[model samples]
Target: MSKATVYFGIILLLAVVIYFSLGSNFHNSTTSDLNFGTFSMKIPRYWKKIEFDGIDSYIGGITNETDSLTFDYGWYSYNLSYENREKQLFATDTINGKIALITKPKEVGNGTLGIYIEEAYKKNRFNFLGKNILDEQIVFEIFKSIRFKDSDTTLNSKSFGFTDKITPYSGRSLFYTHCASCHHRNKNLFGPAFASINELDFKKWIIDTTNLGLTGMAKFGIRYHQKAFKKLLMDNDIEKLIEYSKVST
Candidate 1:
């Protein structure tokens, strides 16, 4: 064969080798099925799973040179009122035979989507971060794969427990059910401890500071409501929480 012909054949061989190499990597990448008592999802193999103790949730992610992607599934319950609906994506759809509310991620600004699913008294929120890594379409595909396990066969079969229940009753119970996940009586998990702040400051912190986009706290007021708080706790309960804090500190 002529010199040009030989060079062309060599180039073609290189292209073929590169294609199969990439194909092999893609094929070998494993996908993991994650079962979080409330729901299950299939995650790409590249992502590494991270487990949190004492919390019924799963967080996993993979990072690269240019971008990163993370997935988080946690138990959360909320009633979407008109005001709440306005801030969301203004859309609703069914995933795995359950109605799910779609919310665009305002924090990431990378087109990440959040799927909120409610079943009986159990609710869960799935958050996809890093839109640069996984676009909206891919995110939806991953989210649509989520399946709610049978109620009787869930990981937490013990009455769905505190994470799923919305008991706004005594402040002590309220603290345990909600605040305890991120905070302890005297130590800090995700945020500061209650023992550090006085009762007045603690009440003010929950009512205003917690939702003010503070350094450590996110805006929780948007998801939880005062009406629900009242339904869950009485005036006496609030006082009790304050008194308890004083004694515990």
Candidate 2:
């Protein structure tokens, strides 16, 4: 019952509220969960699906349609299977169409659902929350995986869909929030930059470094095992991160 103790309690309560309100990746999302191969990346609630018209390109988007941000997700025998499912995507779009050419096999790591993100007047960049109309669109090709609902057997299922949390984080934003503490834009501070490490060990280093503290630096990550961020971000985030680094470096 001391004054100092009471103030500390209030501060702790505010911190928790901010963490839940702003920090949670599900704060303003709308989906069940994104599927990374067999792994599940939880999506927010209340989000719907996007419906494409079999055309490669999209046009005539205004800056007021919140509903337009959500699109119908489907994949046929070649690319139109899930005419209803919903999911998140990191992509780029043109007036013509998407651009995902999966050359390598799809795995839990390093899987890119290449797609073009079209916006109002072609603003191809990450805008955090889905801004006005196409200014914040996220569309992509399907990752071939096994699903319990789609496949005849439970062996595997390839989930396909669009997402409300479609836009990926910008490189500049990622650097400030995620890497600024221990890393710089050009050189490595605690560990290394995007150009320093390989893709395979990047995630592992993030986990083990936080757990065991590899090298001289201790575990200083912002979102390695966060319940919200972990559920929201896919390996593609890392790839986007790498792409971000190339620009910075």
Best-fitting candidate, measured by TM-score? Answer: 1
Model 2, runs deviating above 4 Å: 1-168, 206-232
Q: In candidate 2, how many Å is residue 60 off? A: 28
TM-score of each: 0.39, 0.26
Going through the candidates in order, what is the number of backbone clashes in each?
Answer: 2, 31
> On a 0 to 1 TM-score scale, where does candidate 1 land against the true structure?
0.39
Q: Which tens-of-lDDT digit does each residue in 4-47 have in candidate 2?
A: 99999999999999888875666444435544232222333433
Scored against the true structure, residue 71 in model 2 reaches a CA lDDT of 24
Task: Name the top lDDT candidate.
Answer: 1
